[model samples]
Target: MVSLSGSWLANGGGIWMLAAFYGATAAYGIHVGDRSSEVVESTRDVGDAAANFAGFKISTVNLSGQNHVSPGEILATAGVKPTSSLPFLDAEAARMRLEEMAWIKRATVQKFYPDRLDIQVVERQGYALWQKDGKINVIARDGTVIAPYSDDPRYVKLPIVVGEGAEAHVVEIVEALDLVPGVRDQVRAAIRVADRRWTLKLRNGIDVRLPETGLDGALASLAVFDRDKSLLSRDITVVDLRLADRVTVRLSDAAYEARQADLKARAKAKKGSNT
Candidate 1:
């Protein structure tokens, strides 16, 4: 039973007056199916009235774990009006709608009684910058494209990955170089070469050729060589680790000439010692 009070009524209309108003709305001739339909409608209306009287109208909307995406956008996507009823809200559908946004990697929408709705969201993290067709995009760890990179200062410092298949294999490239952060930090870009192998362009303009197979071993060997010989700092143009058994370092023209002169001098000194 619901008690009718003048103060509790909306727009200064009492429940007794409103109920009477609806009661006198129309004259209904007694029919077989009409009575059942009217009873069902009346029952539904009473339930809605009870719910409204008990303060089930939406009053609070709480949001947490949101970043990158604003709360206003989420609420708009949810389509829940300020006076929406908690009973009619589809939490799962609202959650799916919220997750449709690119920035929202995952989300949860829940409606509480006594007029409140809550949203929880987990935003995607920017992993690297992917360049394709001269357009750069911020990519997530799993290669999901977040948004187009357009002079965004936040993503300016991320590692640049290029080529069509680079996004999918970028995780492996980063993982292989994880053990060599010192050298990895100096990497300007990681390019997928011929859609088969990877070539790392170093900050100093040296192109490090990585092998198609046994990448871990090749990277490990490079790490060891770099640590032992300060290989990256030398006047080397290319560091080829394509062959599993040998390391090939291509020198600049000047360095190659200097190396040839030093080898000839050593050969001559050896011949002199023998003579």
Candidate 2:
């Protein structure tokens, strides 16, 4: 019985040796195969396949810090496919791809050993709408264009800025308007004139030409006028606030004609009374 047990142990050792040899040969063959053919598959894909076979397949992706961007977009951008493996994933490269998206301000990626990945992203917030050369886009607070206008309600109510160089300087006017919500709320758009000054177009179809300097005081005065005298509700087409001392108003065609006729009638009545 002892001799029989010894023979069995020897045969078991031989079987283990043969298994080791086969494993080494298989690994070397895979290495040679990866180097030999470019058309067969990329090195990354081969590594991913081997890693997956070794029980390192990516089974879970923990994503966070995303709102405007979707999970699918993040996964696609990071190249995390159905067959991706954690052992072969490039975290830094995936981060760069995520940041390439307009909505993503910054991104981070991490791979967990065996079967998990963690992706975090900070998304750009839509600050306003900028229109130039007949095209409109959603812009971030720092003036980066987030995307083209798609009538998304999330950005539809934002203040519209038009003209050249508006996107880069929109924050200035937006902050200025924010100080005076009385004027800001009534504004439909802010047009950048000659890339130097701003002209506020009110919702009531009134164009207010603002001075290049003392913008805050001008907006404040406009707010006062709207608050006290309901100036914005008047039948005026334009309000020129370029001059520091006075506000010049241009009436609509109908209002202008009516005012002219009323002035003429008052003058005739005064002349007849004097006679």
The candidate scoring highest on TM-score is 2
| Cα lDDT tens digits for candidate 2, 120-222 | 8899999999999899999999889989999778988988999998988899899999999989999999999999999999999999999999999999999
Highest-scoring model, lDDT: 2
Question: What's the C-alpha lDDT at position 21 in model 2?
Answer: 39
Give the whole-model CA lDDT for all candidates, comma-separated. Answer: 0.76, 0.82
My TM-score estimates for the predictions, one after another, are: 0.74, 0.79
Clashing pairs in 2: none
lDDT of 2: 0.82
lDDT of 1: 0.76
Looking at candidate 1, what is the lDDT of residue 226?
A: 85
Instruction: Show where candidate 1 strays beyond 4 Å.
Output: 1-55, 150-153, 260-275
State the lDDT of candidate 1 residue by residue for 1-275, as single tens digits.
Answer: 11122333233445664454334233221222365766644543443454444445455678888878777787778766543445545689789998888888899987767566788899898888998889889998888898989677888988888998989887888887777787788899999887788999999999999999988888888888888999989999999999988999999999999999999999999999999
Clashes of each: 0, 0
